[model samples]
Target: MNEHYNRWLHHRGLDPDLMQELLLLSQDEIEDCFYRHLDFGTAGMRGLLGPGINRMNLYTVRRVTEGLARTLIAQGDDTRKRGVAIAYDSRRFSPEFGAEAAGTLASHSVRVYLYPSLRPTPMLSYAVRHLGAAAGIMITASHNPASYNGYKVYGSDGAQMPPHRVDKILQALAGIDELALPSHSLQDGIASGWIKEIGSEVDTAYYNHVLSLSHENNATANQQLKVIFTPLHGTGNRPVRHILGELGFTQVHTVSAQETPDPDFPTVSAPNPEEHDVFTLALTEAEQYTADIVIGTDPDADRLGLYARNPAGNYTAFNGNQIGALLLHYTLERKAAKGELSSQGIVLKSIVTSEMGRSIASSFGVKMEDTLTGFKYIAEKVDRYEALNTPFLFGYEESYGYLLGSFVRDKDAIQAAMMCCEMAAYYKQAQNLTLTEVLEILYQQHGAYIESIFSFTFQGKKGLEKMSTLMDTLRNQPLKQIADLPIAQVKDYRLGIDHLPKANVLKYLCTDNSWVAIRPSGTEPKIKFYISAVADIIDAAQEKKKRMEKDLRDRLETSL
Candidate 1:
């Protein structure tokens, strides 16, 4: 018997059912589950829910909250009094885990303002700042599979707790010796005013702010434009539809099958909108309605996907980079036309996002800045630029995440949906062009830019070791060329540059301006390779991207 496994099984405070389940785990499962505690990366602790320290269960949630509580306590009584805001998405046990976190913080004498039901992540950020809370906790795995759940911590600034604060939280977590300690009673906290349930007030305020971001206030008056939206059984349903309905969008139709919040996500294999396959039900519905455009939000409602009717009259999906480029063009073009474009206006994208946005921003005389791969970094820029008295026009990552307004500190699918819909309505009504057509014009003007991401999932201990070894090999022995393209520049983010924190990421720019980035996903058990290709013609760019993908796969196979 592994000592760690037995220690957990024999712990007196362990849940009896969980202990029995652990007792029955196969040898390999036991090792996989008990080998080590789940690593709390920059994002927070996320893993499969099961009976082990490595999984996301009540105990792990409590431990993380305990760390957060300790960090807040150290910040002083005022910080603790300001408390933390808590919200959850439509995942199994999400509410239970959220309540557990609230109890844990209350046990530490810290106040908690928790959403009464499932809510999107951005609302948690808004609530944190709006309610003057010291921190926020969102219980979600974002777009990960249903088997996974997560706990993401946000700073008082409503961004993901920055690296320095994350370090302090980790320091406090290290001091926690007991993993299965029960938290205080949530009911007791509520009765004593230490835990407050927040609902309609926050929702109304968030809805109003998102509505204010719309450039076309009367966009809903375009009753002729057919629109279809789906929330994929997550938290986006109410807020997204509510905003659209209030905006007077007369022809909005939500995918009825996916409107209800279901943790099982019964209709789709994965709830991620990035995967076109997940939009099967929505597409079918769109075709029936001959919808002008189709929009869908992921499980947490943070990432959005757009499907538009192509020249061939079929619903074609847009990649994250393509979506970002289209939105950037629409926003900047409209703002410039309205004389709202600021001299100090800027757009922010992650390092791996498509350069097409940069081209669009430059055409409008707006500066484009690159941050590390997460939205947290983008949010940091938003906060910084606001303080500097510059306008943050828009921000997006290549993973289908976008933010248009500073009202929310995280990627907001609700806001993206509103803006994308408004843009579509404007183009159709005024320019006599569909969004896809506008995208083609942008591509023609900027040259064709194609981007693709390839990820290799490594599930268990061996997989993790392989991923580490692969990163190490890439870092130590860099590739000079990919498919005969000469490497022009190599940027190793780990060494740090431009005031950004050190990260395990590598990017190689080719002589032809094409680039490929290699990094392990901070939140998932996969190593991701991001490839971007540019050519005068779209066909040429597509061919180059396919060749690059093939070459990358071959190299990874050999290296691993």
Candidate 2:
């Protein structure tokens, strides 16, 4: 660790700000930052921006870009010409990091279509497919705090690159041993046409596609629904509002303080839509105007979070599973009503998502499938469905991610925002129902299902070790029962059951249709516990979930 730290400390021509940052870090911080080179994990590369081998900074960014450039070059000239599309969110250093990536790719004679200004991750996915690019680069940390940043690579299909392809990129990245490599300046790349600037044309195209998803008769609901939206000071403001406006949604209200892009994300603690705290400002604004829905999207706009007014006139925040169920039901209902539903159509979700989604799909005679636990897996499934000539009706996860149309392969808040408003409006005008009421009806019809999430974060080296031990213990010394419920089955993903790839995940199926899944987060330093409870009623489900969680905590809490 000291040697790694000294290498950067003494390296000539180091970034000046980085050098100052290096000089000030405490001993523990130094060790934390210098212990290892940042590698591509389940997600793409991400970390706090700083001057360390493991940290996120210009040097690390360039190294990864150079690795990507080499990997692209190896794929042959045709792929290189197809280029890479680059987009960024409103995180600090996002633009600089994006420009640097473009310049790096250009330096290798690879073509680049770089967004002129900040845009969301879904736009990058769309740009990749629309331009027929070989791959795409999204410079963002998603919903992470302002101090962190990330670089995610997408395949030509416009999804996060699968693990096998990412493995090649990592191998190429690991082989890079020097920093003094050929590089082109942003100006040089732009002037030489190696890196072309892209905007309005693509934005207009995207807005049009999302708008096209709206049903013709839904215009009345779109106009009558009063909606409040907050981007949480990221990239969703312009495109989200633009689509809503184009759909005749004139009553949309934007939180003025968060309407513009601010890298600092001053209004929220972490800029994550999943957290209720992030919606504080939007909910406040919703109450002032008596808005029907309060919507919030994260930094890169790939995920969405929402709250809707209930029958009693109080706003309620809905978790990811509830929202996913609602969206799945709404889309299928609209399709069935229009005679657009297909017997071969299927809905995709992560393995850990609520089973209620499957019930919704089954009721409509649509198939529902589960992937491991990432949007990339869902994306892969969508590609397969296309090959088999089946339409993908919808895809979602326990996280606030939903994909309606296949145009943009990754999870898209842009689509979620529009459909959410359309759904709320349609129900409001036709059924005289609030989203809360509709949700209850679905629950009552499709067995009351409840899901609870437990995340224990383990930071740094020791934390990683602890997580490994915990996973190993649970895998080897498996529990046979929980809360006095017999465990019907146990799935250890490390052995790659269910024809899926090997992953460090464990799932327990109980006799009463309840289940629990334990796995470490691919993107963050945390282990997540997903408990899904199913029963004939909400109270029964809640009680079972409470007892199961308590039992699990009793058995495992001491280890941590």
Instruction: Return the TM-score for each candidate structure.
Output: 0.98, 0.98
Clash tally, candidates in order: 0, 0
Residue range with the least summed lDDT across 10 consecutive positions in model 2? 175-184
**Candidate 1, 74-132: lDDT as tens digits:** 98999999999999999988999999999989988899998998999988989998999
| Candidate 2 residue-pair clash tally | 0
Tens digits of per-residue lDDT, candidate 2, 131-186, equal 99999999999988888999999999999999999888888977574345544579
Instruction: Give me the displacement of residue 429 in model 1, in angstroms.
Output: 0.9
lDDT of every model, 2 decimals: 0.89, 0.90
Question: So what's the TM-score on candidate 2?
Answer: 0.98
True-structure lDDT of candidate 2: 0.90
Q: Please state the error at residue 10 of candidate 1 in Å.
A: 0.6
